[model samples]
Target: MSNTPSLTANLRSDLPAALVVFFVALPLCLGIALASGAPAFSGLIAGIIGGIVVGALSGSQIGVSGPAAGLAAIVLTAIGSLGFENFLVAVVLGGLIQVGFGLLRAGVIGYYFPSSVIKGMLTGIGLIIILKQIPHFLGYDADYEGDQSFWQVDGENTFTEIINALGNPSVGATTVGFIALGILLLWSNVLSNKGKIFTLIQGPLVAVAAGILYYVLTQGNPTWGVAPEHLVRVPVPKSFDDFLGQFTFPNFGAITNPTIWVTAFTIALVASLETLLCVEATDKLDPAQRVTPTNRELIAQGSGNILSGLIGGLPITQVIVRSSANIQSGGKTKMAAIIHGVFLLLSVIAVPTLLNKIPLAVLAAVLLIVGYKLANPATVSAIYRSGWKQFGPYIVTVLAIVFTDLLTGIALGLVVAIIIILYKSYQNSHFLHRVDSDDAAGRHHVQMQLAEEVTFFNKAAILRELDGLPEGAILELDVRKTRYLDYDIVEILENFATKARDRGIDIEIIAVGKRVMNPPSYMKFFDLAPAVEGH
Candidate 1:
């Protein structure tokens, strides 16, 4: 088991990683809100809560939590149906429900998920990222700006949106986007290998800087300059008072609404699942392959959601986008997570105006790269190599996620994976009987071959056969070939052996090592009998 290290080492590893996470998180915060039809500030609040509150409470060193794209569609529908004020009440209640889940110890579900499905999920998500970011890269904003669905935003569906964006392109935005893309590609592929300058400066950072410079050069011009429509337009609060004025409070009065309760439960369940999945996936990506504590993560997420809801912010979870960025950026501890939160808080206060200057196109370019990496072909190839048992579930999960919404797709994949597991278990639990008879009394012998390993999954099959044993039968359990047997099966066998002795049935064991049957001195009378050869 891995132990949590000292605070000093954590700080040293986390600080720099947090900086990278901050950069990755900023746009996502804004984009998710835009997609969900919520106030852009809501996303920022969620990010802050996810980092400060969730980060502090979570057991994961590398998992970064924040507003998730997966929840955007749900949030959008809930707000529209329940009204924004009432929806917020549900969000608060949702956090409370998540706390309940932690208390119930429901976090272990993550462990049962098939490895194939999980791999497929990661690869599918990566592909979606690449596809969704294309319009933004081309300066063609077809969808509601931050949509993550496979279908397009022009009310035409995903495929149509791609076509429409291609049909109509904004030259100025496209040019800036292409330039940014070129710079990113060069920095990642070529520049990083050459010198210290390349090593120190990331491609995304350079693309953003170049974009801002381009905007500045074309500041006064009408045709060449980046337009306001193409820029990231955060609410510009003029002063500290104005900024404070932007904060919205939840409608505590709506707490009694049944609709509020339903939405709350929905948010809590969906958010918790997403967080668990992301934590699992992020851990796999970690160079160290560290396992995060799922229960602790639930507690942290619940706390963050509570804070976010209280502040009239969006619900949050362990977001893979920022978490992956943290890993890639060489983050080593939770300090990076805390620092990223601080950066979010400071940026809104100290450099709100500067942030406002960044073109949405530039951010789009950054996301395009992030998305491509998530859904890359290399990931698919890797999954395929892990064997069909893993690949089958993985592919199913990927397709489900892509064709439908995230939660629905995951549920489908999980069910399929579970069925496969049960089928394999049943196939492994077979008993073969070979009988030889030559006398007038019709004497016969039976031999049962235990599986290579027996587990609880095979208990039913073994039990059914043992319960139906015939009278005057000679039973021989062959353990010479069995390497390991689960304690559950062993206990059952012991009981059956006692019953067989009572029934006057002949029972014998083969190759039973001394280590197999060391009864307690108190129960010496019931001590295990020795094995017989060819009984």
Candidate 2:
């Protein structure tokens, strides 16, 4: 195993990456909070805590933490039921519960999830990103931005929301959004080819800058300019003291509320699952293929959430949006994560007015591009070529997310994946046993025949026959017709071989080939010999 990189070197490499992450995280922080029915300032608080606290404690090198869209539905419901102030209490408690989970080392739960389910989750989330962002891209503010559920707020569901948004479009916002998107695409392709300037400035930054400049030029003209409704409104804190005063304390009195407890538990469970899933996905994207410590990540997330909630912020987690951006930006350490947090804090305090100048339409364009990258056609094609087992779950997950909400869609996809795994297990093989009585000397003969492929799934039946065999009986294992055997099954056979010898039973392994019988002692019977003459 390679030793952990030095902290000084890690920090140096992460600073520049963190600057990139800050740009990515800023709009998402505000957008998610706006979508979750929480105060926009609260989202900034969560981002700051996630970066400064979570990033400091996290074991993951590249995963950036912040308020997630996955928790939007839950937060909206919790606030409606418990009231915003009371909900803050639940958020704080949820962070505490997450801390407890980390101390208990519950992060291993992430590893138990099947690969199919995980892939489904990624695809589902990608589709959700695309679906939820479409309204924003079109400049329709009917629903809160970042709402991923198929259902919309106007009493209409997902389908209705689309219809309504299409019927009543904000032409000004739409035009600006498209213009910004065009600029981004052009910048990514043409401008990037020019030199160092394009290399240093990303497409998103360019889009945002152009949108701000456009807004500045058209500020006096109502018809041509972007409206206040379509712009990002960051809370303006007059002074350093005023900025510090924006932080709210959790209402600890709500601790006794049963609803609060339920909300806390829900946040803990969902956030942990999301974090683990993101961690796994991040590892796959890592060029070095390093595995993060899942348990440690939970602890870091827990601490970050605690700080966020204590300061009257939303729940926090390892958000894939920022993490993907971090990786794509060449972030190599946790320092990038910490720096992003610092930028969030500074932007809100020192430059809140400048940030507000950036039009929402431009931000929408940035998100649309991000969503497109996530749900790219190439990704879908790659998943399809991996086979139905992979593609089936992937497609189901995407559809579910597009049709429903994040958690529900993931659950449904997971159920489908489990069913597929079980079906594959059943198709692998059958087990059979035979016993015959010989007239001469009253001897008995026992035989066990395995199908072409025997896996760990059939261990119970094999073990039962081996244990039930009578002493002094002649035992025979017929593998001549078997084509493949799982390694786990072979180990069981090897153990049984040792026990049978001690029991004085006559044991024979039929059709052992010179090459096949040479299996390592740990996996003696797992070998597949060439087919012998006759059945």
Candidate 3:
């Protein structure tokens, strides 16, 4: 059977998935835009391009693209540091660099990230989603919806914001939050299994429709009415020209600036990593377990961002949040993603007023569910059981991301992974054994076989073995399994050879019968001869 299914084969499934994703993505786009310090419509632009442009170009069957919450902090800082127009230039430049990465096959870098770290990233982002959304969930939305940073622009940290949310809650917002949350939980647990009709209507969409109704009905009661500030705010163009005028053009003249290039490279690097990571994660969430061609995904993302930047949109990436929602909603093909994009574009133009009626609290409740799925305690326990080598990086990554930012947390995890590798190399560099033979010679044999690859890090262990040998013994230095021996170890062997006679020890060195690799320059610089002798 063919791996790729016909796009129209699953329209029954894809259509509902598309509607569900459309509802899920709408608030996220607006929220990420607000968080990034960009005009809210810019996020919709990115989301639209992500769904139509990237989704159409990508080979991923279930993965969805959008303005990522992970990039919000970067977008916010870049806009402030470079000015909005200059930052748009950086975004464009970043898109070109991403295209280069795709061409160069830099997508393979994603494979190098440890599984523990990747899990940590997902879990970390999940926690960030939960923590950052608490205020909005409670209706005191002083901060933007998708602001994932530890220290917010409002000068309140994640903890302080939570405390404040508890102190001052909005009755309308709080009421909508619980009601929406209840509706989601009920739909997911009970109603979703009822029939086709229930499945077709997504919990999020239903919750949103209910919230909008609640908002309209509560208008007469001031205390329980959701304020305009707590509702979705997509710009409604006065006319066609006004709609076109919303997009801000990049300042191409700023391309020559060094700061612009630096910002571009940073955005390119970070966005690419985030995209690749999400690709891996979304594949796991796929029911069919279909794989995404990551390099092609990079190209699609590059193209989308280029278009998005030209028309004033936040940078786009394959976002796990929306992609997961799409998958969980039973999205079958790229068509679902494309349809969601079309909906986004049409909604702002045709029914911005209807979307504006959605209370932010309802969206927060929806995200809270998604956040919980990402950071499930079961997932954390499974990671812990994978042993310290995996857990160390995983836990550190989670903590770092929770306390700091996404990039910093991953950096710390990578460092821990390297440390684990080095420690294992140091401990497992060689095999040591003792042999007592009842031969005519009556010789006691001590054998030490070198690991497949030995470097300077193993020198101390080799030296300690050599120094502790008995006064009269046969020491077998086995290099038969060694692929490459370091110069430092060679020098140690040579020095020991000179002292072995005085200590009444006879040493025999063994190397592979196959041809030996010539020593590196470092060996020659040390003037140490190879201790290997072919059988």
How good is model 1 by TM-score? 0.80
**Backbone clash tally for model 1?**
9
- In the range 1-535, model 1's lDDT, one tens digit per residue, is 7466654676645665576577668877888898888889999999888888788888888788889988998899998888777788888888888888988888887787666766767777766666666666666665655466765334665566667778876666777888888997888788878986775656777787888888888886766677767777667788889898777888888788888898899899899999888888888888877898888788788888888988878999998878887777667767677788988888888888888777767877777777677777787888789777777788888888777656666778888888788878876775668676723666456677776666778888888777776766777666656555666777787677777767665666654563322222212211342332211
Q: Give the count of colliding residue pairs in each prediction.
A: 9, 1, 0
Against the reference, the lDDT scores of all candidates come to 0.76, 0.76, 0.85
Model 2 agreement with the true structure over 1-535: per-residue lDDT tens digits: 8666655686644665677677667777887888888888888889999998998899888889999888988898998898888888888788888889888989998787667666666666666666666666666667666566777554666667766768876776777788888987897769878987776666666777888888888886767777777777789987878877887887888689898999999999999998988888777766667788998888888888878888889999998778877776667877888889998888887888998887777777766666666677888898899999888777877788778877777677788888787777665454445555574766568766667667677777678778888776777677766766777777787787788778766666666553332233524333334542111
Q: Which residue segments of model 3 deviate by more than 4 Å?
A: 436-444, 513-535
TM-score each candidate: 0.80, 0.79, 0.91
Q: What is the C-alpha RMSD of each candidate to the true structure, in Å?
A: 6.4, 8.2, 3.7
The Cα error of candidate 1 at residue 446, in Å, is 7.5
Better of 2 and 3 by TM-score: 3
TM-score, structure 2 vs. true: 0.79
Say which prediction, candidate 1 or candidate 3, comes out ahead on TM-score.
3
